[model samples]
Target: MLYTNITSINHFFITGFPGLSLEHYGIVSCLLLVLFLAIVFGNMFLLVFVKCESSLHRPTYLIFCHLALTDLTFGTVTLPKIISKYWFDDSIISFYGCFAQMYFIHLIGAAHSFILMVMALDRSIAIYAPLRYTVLFTNTSASVLCVISWLLPTSWMVGVVLDALSLPYCNSNIIVQCYCDHIAITSLGCENVRDVHIVAFGLAMFSLLVPLGFIIISYFIIIVAVMRISSAQSRIKTLSTCTPQLLITFLYYMPRCFVYLANNVGFTFSVPVRIVVVMLYSLLPAAVNPIIYCFKTKAIKDSLKRKFLVRKVNIRTKT
Candidate 1:
């Protein structure tokens, strides 16, 4: 392997798993197909269900709808090309195509983080100021926040994407990770990418930590408020309402921060372990969110039963 640069290598090969054998590619592909379908149907169903159900048109449900869209987009941006790579051995992604993928991956990822923070804020407000929650957080307000979540990340990621794009890539066009992302692309650059990564890291930290900080504070206030309740049953009941979101939030944040921190500080992970960790945190939250965040709600559960079971029984009786 002589060091001759491809000067303008138009495509980068996605190494599905650097360590995994080609024989196992299909198996991983099948699993990813399942996860992708789950993410698609799960989030899409919630969005469609929200649209069709008049009862679910409120700000609370709108927040979840925003999250559903974010998760849906996140999975779509990362999954298909990788699935194609694993299943069909089509690993080539054009320079701009990779750029688009990298851009959206970071943007959607940041949006998801901020959206989760919004959800935490929504919960906090409801728990801490029940009476004022309705007044303080309205449909208009939630909608605005949702728009901001999608837009705010756009500005932060654009510079990073542009920096990576401008840099000259060498002969090797192999991306270590499953997808084209800021870090993956920057690492391929022939330039000194330390500053770019640092800037990206700073922006990433701000996007993650600011919202995370708020969520933590919001939860703290919420916990304090919950504890003040005199009835043990009521306290348990209130905390029960929060468990699902808290669970998803933990899944969303902790692993991502760990991976980011590891990448920046030069913490070494086996390639397989690193990719698997990335995929789990990235995809699992999206896949499980519909179940944990949406369907777990009593209203949605009852609606499901009415829409399916009741309708089935009615048809049977009519027949």
Candidate 2:
């Protein structure tokens, strides 16, 4: 039964792809499911590889582990809801449930962004001050920074969620996209959402743009420093370490920027276009992270082989 508050909006109208056929939804469902699996399995391998390999117990890998965890959490927060919408004929999320979804989405999203910034700083220190990298990004320091990264975004999300919920919602409650995105939800509010938009935009810029700017600056310095190194091998090695981070930064930032720009400018792109953009923003990073990092690092490859091959051999012997 749909819950209704007499004074508030009784039901939300979700404005999904009106012209999208069942065949299209099926294709999208299969692709999304595959992507979700890849994200989960890939991130799982990363976490396991880090845990099993004692040699990988450096501050850099520690931060990488946290980043993978964030990606996994972020993927889990949205992908299930998306899959549900695609698989079920009638999918509806309760008000509180939608709020919770948005909260976690922002929390993990912010954590992921902050971790990327931390990773940039880590790389910069490693490149520019190799001697101090250990002392600076120590285990204690990494722990503190990781905790702060998780907490800071969570705090910001709580404030945003509270403020958003306070606004009166009229008959328009249905979210346009699969999940409860802040921008989509804000558009449904009956009350003036100018203040909400301002606050949300401020938070988004702080979390996304500011860190992105720092990453760009850090990479610029790192690149220049790499060029100064005379040895070809050293230059290649330095660039390799930063490459994975750079790829992730681009994957995350570009789509996010597009989404924010589209929302702010009130661009009336088709629902399918917006859906594709949102899916790419949400899924691609998760799908790419493990593949990029694991393939780049021989150590991770060896760990995966050992973990898988050893288990296979043991199973054969048991059989």
Candidate 3:
């Protein structure tokens, strides 16, 4: 038994996402598998394309590569457990297992938020200082920024995990979500988690809300700057470059905001609604990221075409 009364439920049944039925597991599994592949392969392709294309060796794309890596890590941290839930019917994670999941989820999530902020900063510098962009965002500076982005989140997550673990879960041990989310797990505690809630909320604001605010402000400034440019063609080109990023930002930020709001306000949706929200939050960004890159950037599309054509030619030659 994982919990004694005032809790007494050891291992609660986690129904995959929020509303997914056992009868629909096969369909959900197929959809999720497709999404998983797209997220993983898409990010990998972006990373490789950036590396192999000499023309793409700039500060902007460098940050994008890092962003892709972070997205890949973030998706990997959450989706595997979701897949397992559908495949194995095993939703019961142990106490320690739950803690570990929370740690990595928060870590990658914070890293994702930080990377978005960095990307916004990169854009700000690029738009504001075209001539000095290279000098301002050198490889060394970018590398340092990336390290800080990763380390800060790592430290915060470690603290959260430690604090959560220290709390006595003397009541129930069942996590509501398919995976062990910190907010969901903390809510199950029998003891007062006021301090824990405060800390978690603080971190969420710092990691998610702050970065989101920065991105919005950065884009606002960017739009103003772009509008002031007298050349219509140049303005169009600038807007085009920013559009893909804006789409990504919208998709990433809105669902996260919903989830955080839901957690904070004690907004209780039905199981299906909750599952949809969580699934969208976890999966959509990963799925959309690659598609955005592939469609928005000609360089990636051309490279993929070349690789596919080369493979086709080789197959014909062999036959």
* Cα TM-score per model: 0.94, 0.89, 0.88
- Candidate 2 wrongly placed segments (more than 4 Å): 1-6, 10-16, 258-268, 305-319
Per-model C-alpha lDDT, please? 0.87, 0.81, 0.78
Q: Give per-candidate clash totals.
A: 0, 3, 4
Count backbone overlaps in model 3.
4
Cα lDDT tens digits for candidate 3, 1-319? 3456653344444556655568988777777778888889989988888898887777667777887887888778777777777877667666676678788888887887887888888777778777898889886787678778889888878888888877766676656676777878888777899999899879978998888889988888888888889999999887787766777777888877877677779987887678677877777787788788778866666777888899999999999
All candidates: CA RMSD in angstroms?
1.9, 3.2, 3.0
Instruction: Please write out the lDDT profile of model 1 over residues 1-319, one tens digit for every residue.
Output: 2234667777788886777898888899999999999999999999999889888777878988998998999999999999999999998899899999999998998898898888898889889999998899998999899899999999868888887888888767888889997888888888798998888888888888999999999999999999999999999888877887888789888888788688779998888788888888888999999997665676777777778998899999999
| Candidate achieving higher lDDT, 2 or 3 | 2
Where model 3 places Cα greater than 4 Å from the true spot, the runs are 1-13, 18-20, 258-268, 302-319
Which candidate do you rate higher for TM-score, 2 or 3?
Answer: 2
Report the lDDT tens digits of candidate 2 across residue range 108-222: 8888898888889888989988888888888778767887889998887899999998988754566777677898888877778999999987898899887899998998889
Clashing pairs in 1: none
Best by TM-score: 1
